[model samples]
Target: MEMTSRTKKFTYYRRKATNVIMLSSSFFSAIITIIPLFLVFYYTVREGLRYLNIDFFTKLPTPIGEPGGGMVNAIVGTLILIGIGGGIGIPVGMLSGIYLSEFGKNKFGTLVRFLADVLSGIPSIVVGVVAYTLVVLPMKHFSALAGGVALAILMIPTITRTTEEMINLVPHSYREAALALGIPKWKTILFIVLKTAWKGIATGVLLGLARAAGETAPLLFTALGNRFWSTNIFRPIASLTVFIYEYSKAPFKDWNEQAWTAALVLIMLISIVSLVFRLITRSKY
Candidate 1:
């Protein structure tokens, strides 16, 4: 009887010790994950603060040898590229996703999902080459349109998979309820299913845009980068990623500072997009 009591107490303490060790390890793991993110933010702000100003956002890049300039054109070009890319990619991706979630239990759906996965894993440089061949070659110019096409291709797989997953998350009960209201299948999907899933879908789109914003290799072969201010989609345009790559590699001190500032700007842009999406998703319906 004493031996049984001793065994029970030992087992209780053993389980407690195991739980404590597990909890401690998980807590440390989280800290390890978060510390690097904080460090990167700290370094980027420290290194980039001196160069960030109204002029940096407003002026064009000065000549290479000259010191005082800004990345105004690059900022504008980045926005335009994302706009065009999102416009082209979002609709197609959503349509594909809707089909996959709602009507794709077959072999064709599996093939499409597999293809999307493969496309997402392909190197950004490879996408650039494909875009250059399809858009730049046909247009006979390295244009913002070509850059957008590359980014669009990169964005598509993300949006499609997110949309499919989010749509599936909408409980089948919701579908049944809507269908019982005498709604047609297509109408139920468009009005009920899509509206319910819009927030998650938007988050996926924003995440894709954020990922595309920092890509440089695709722009290298496709848009090919511009030196001057250019808003024309048909003409080559500058990008923040490309500008940062060029500036950071240059021997000039000022250009290097500008590169850090561009990195900060890119991070801020992505943060703002994520914040906006969060706000929209949580807003009162």
Candidate 2:
């Protein structure tokens, strides 16, 4: 009996020690992860605030050697590019996702899944090269359309996989219930499964948007960066990422400061996108 009691005490103490060690590890791991993010944000705000002003939002970028300018054109162009990307990406991604979740259990589906995973791993620069060949070359010029196409390709795999996972999370019982009510399979999927998983799908879309918004390589090959304001989808366009890249490398102090401000603005734009999507996707209940 004494031996058994000592054994029990030994086991208890060991478990307690393991738990404490794990908890400490997790605490330190989280602190390490968050510290870098905090430092980047703090530094960005410190440098960016020096040049941030009303003119930065309302006026056009000035010529080299000029004193002051804003990135209003780049801001507008970024929005338009995102809009174009979303228009092309959302429908194709959602449909592919639905098909994969519902009917992708066979060998063909396996092939498609493999392809998506491969596509997701491809470098953005490679996608830009492909887009340049497919759209820019045929059109005989770099254009916003080519950039939009590049962004859409980058967005597809993320949106498609996120959608498939979200849809699969819906209980099979929900589908059974809908079918038992004499509902058509198409209608049931469209109204029931889709509505239930919309929030998760929206998150995937937001992630894709954020990634596309920050991409410079793809836009460099496809859009080519414009100096003047132009909204034509067939024309080269400016964007925040390209502006930041160019300004950060300039010899002028003012342009370098504007780079910091542009970086901060890009962060703000991404945050705003996240917020708008969150509100739109909020639970109706």
Candidate 3:
């Protein structure tokens, strides 16, 4: 009896120590992750503040050494491309997610799930190449439309996965309750299940947008940056990512400063969007 008591005490003490170690490791990892974000914001704001001006938000890009040239064109182009991508991707992704969660126990659903997994793993540059060949080459020009399409491809898998998981998390009781009211399966899903999961779905869409916004490789051969202001979806457009890429490669100090400023803008935009989404999800709204 004494031996058995000692064995139990030893196991309990070991488990307690292990849990303490695990908790400390997790705390340190979280601190490490947060430190980089703070450092990045500090550095970006410190370096980029000199270039930030009213003109920087209003005027268009100009010659490399031009003093007053701004990121207005790139900002507009980024918005347009992301808007188009979201418009195309969200509906398709939501539908696919619904199908996967609601009716995807069969062979075809399994195939789709497998394909989504595979597509998610494919590199962004590969998608850009495919977009170039299929959309840009055939059209004989890089345009905002092509970039939007490439970004849409990247957004779809993320949306689908998140939507599927969120929808699945909706309580079975909710669906049953709706059905007991003589509601059809489609109506139940549309009215009850989706309503309950709306916040999660919005979070997924925001995440997808954040991912799409930072992409540079796919936009390289697709949008192919413009120096002047343009609103035409059919023409090449300047985006912050593309502008950052092109400027960072130039041999001019002014252009490099603009690149850093553009990068800061992109980071800030994504962070705001993410925080807004988190707030929306967390609130009763």
Candidate 4:
């Protein structure tokens, strides 16, 4: 009887020690992740805050050696490029995802998933090179269309994978219930399964867009860059990323300040998009 009590006590103490160790490890792991994030944020705000003003958003960028300028054209061009890319990518990605989740239990589906994974892993600069050859060579000029195409390619795999996972999370019973109610398979999938998973899919789409919006390498090869205002899809246009890259390297202190400010704007835009999508994905209705 005494031995049994001692054994029980020994087991309890051993479990308690393991739990304490695990808790301490997890606590430090979280701190390690969080500290760097705050440090970056703090550094960016400190450098960028001084240059963020009303004029920064409304006026066009000034010439080298000029006193005043803004990223108005770059901001507009970025929006236009993102819009074109999202328009092209979202539908195709969603359709591919639906097929993969609903009917991709065969060899063909396996091949498609493999290809998507491969495409996702390819360097963005390589994609930019491909787009430059395909789009710029044919068009004979750098253009926003090429930039849009590059961004779309980058977005597709992310959207496709996120969508497939979200759709699969919907219980099979939902599909079975719809079919039992005399609904056709197509209608059932379109109405029930799709509607149920739409919120999560939207989150994925937004995340993909956010990622595309921040890419610089692809735009460099495809859209190139314009310093002045440009709205045409067939013309080279200013991009926030390119502007930051150029300005941050200049000999002038003012241009360097502009780079930090542009970085802040890009960071805020990404943060907002991510937070919005996270909220949309988490909400239950």
Candidate 5:
């Protein structure tokens, strides 16, 4: 009886130890992931605080050694790129996702899925090259429109995958219920399935936008960069990432400071967008 009791005690201790180890590992993993974010935020704010001002948002980028310049042009260009990219990306992504989830049981669906996976893995620089060839080269000039196309390509795969996953999570019972109520399959999917998965879809779209906003390589050859403010989509436009890249390459102190400031701004913008997406996904709507 003592031996049996000892065996039971040993088994209990083993299980307890396993649970403790698993919990500790998970906690450590989370901390590891968060450490880089904390460091980035700390350093960015430390370096950028001095340059944070209303003038920073209103003035144009100056010559390499000049002071008092800002990223107003870059900010505007980033906004325009995001707007155009999102406008093209969202509809195409959503429809492709719907097709993948609703009608993708065949060979065609498999091919599309494979293509999306391949596209996602392709380097951003490659997308830029393709865009340059198809858009910028064809037009004989770098433009915000070409940059938008490059970003749209990056956005599409992310949006498509997330949307498909979200729609798949909707219960089959919802579809059956709609069908029993005399709703057609297409109508049911349009109203019921999409409504149920709206939050997840929005989350994906926001994440895609965040990803696109920080892309530098894709915009490097596509949008290039403008020295002055440009409203023309057909001409090279300044972007925060491109601004940071260009300024950081120079040896000038003022330009370097501006680069750090631009980096900080981009980080903040992405963080805000991600936080908003999280909040939206958590809400009932």
Candidate 6:
């Protein structure tokens, strides 16, 4: 009896030790994963803070040799590009998602889902190339429109998948209840189902916009970057991403500092966009 008791005690302690070791390892792994993100945020703020000022938000880029300039044009252009991209992408993506969620239990729907997955996996630069061929080559010049098209394409797959998943999460019981009330299928989807899932759909839209905001490669081939202020969709436009890419590579100290400032501003812009949208879409209940 003593021998059996000793064996049981030993086994219990061994299991306890093993559990502690595993828990420690998991905690360590999480720390390792988070460290890099924290470091990047730290460094970006540290380096960018030196040059951030009101002028950076309000003035235009000065001549190359001059020291004082701002990225006003780039900021404005970025907003315009996002607006254009959203205008094209959001409706298409939301409609496609609705169709897939509501009536996509067939081969055609399967094909579309497959295509969206594949498109999501394709390189952003390749999408840039495609946009170039479709818009830039035909127009015979790079323009903000071409860049917007590329961003819209990139936004579509993510928005579509997110919308489908969010809508699907709406309970079947809710749909059935609405249908039994003699509501039309379209009305049920539009008013009953979609309303329930609007917050999730908004999150997805914001995510797509965030991803599109930082893209530099597509703008390289399509928008082609302007140095001055211009909002004409058919003309080249400055954007923060392209501005950062170009200035960061330049030998000038002032331009490099500006690049850091732009990076910081870009992050801030995304945060503001998210917060504003969240407030606008705040749940009433």
Cα error, candidate 2, residue 129 (Å): 0.3
The 10-residue segment of model 4 with minimum total lDDT is 276-285
lDDT of 5 by residue, 1-285 (tens): 999999999999999999999999999999999999999889889998778888879999777556787889999999899888899999999999999999997999999988988889999999999999989987998999999999999999999988998999999999999999999999999999999999889989998999999999999999998889997989999999998898889888878888889998998888987897787678754
> Candidate 1: where is the Cα deviation over 4 Å?
1-35
lDDT of 3 by residue, 186-268 (tens): 99999899999989999999999999999999999999989998989999998999888888899988888888899888988
Over the stretch 213-256, how does candidate 6's per-residue lDDT look in tens digits? 99999999899899898999999999999999999999999899
Q: What is the C-alpha lDDT of each candidate?
A: 0.92, 0.92, 0.91, 0.90, 0.91, 0.94
Q: Write the per-residue lDDT of candidate 2 for residues 55-98, one digit (tens) a residue.
A: 98998999889888899999998988888888898888889999
Per-residue lDDT value at 221 in model 1:
76
Off by over 4 Å in 4: 1-30, 277-284
Q: Is candidate 3 or candidate 4 better by TM-score?
A: 4
Ranking by lDDT: 6, 1, 2, 5, 3, 4
Clashing pairs in 2: none
TM-score of each candidate?
Answer: 0.89, 0.89, 0.87, 0.88, 0.87, 0.92
The lDDT leader among the candidates is: 6
Off by over 4 Å in 2: 1-30
Q: Per-residue lDDT tens digits of candidate 1, residues 1-285?
A: 999999999999999999999999999999999999999899889988989999989899998788777889999999999998999999988999999999998999999999999989999999999999999888898999999999999999999999999999998998999899988999999999999989889899988999999899999978888879999999999999999899899999999999999999999988998998898789846
Q: Candidate 4, after superposition: displacement of residue 175 in Å?
A: 0.9
Model 5 scores a C-alpha lDDT of 0.91
lDDT of 1 at 233: 96
- Clash count list over all predictions: 0, 0, 0, 0, 0, 0
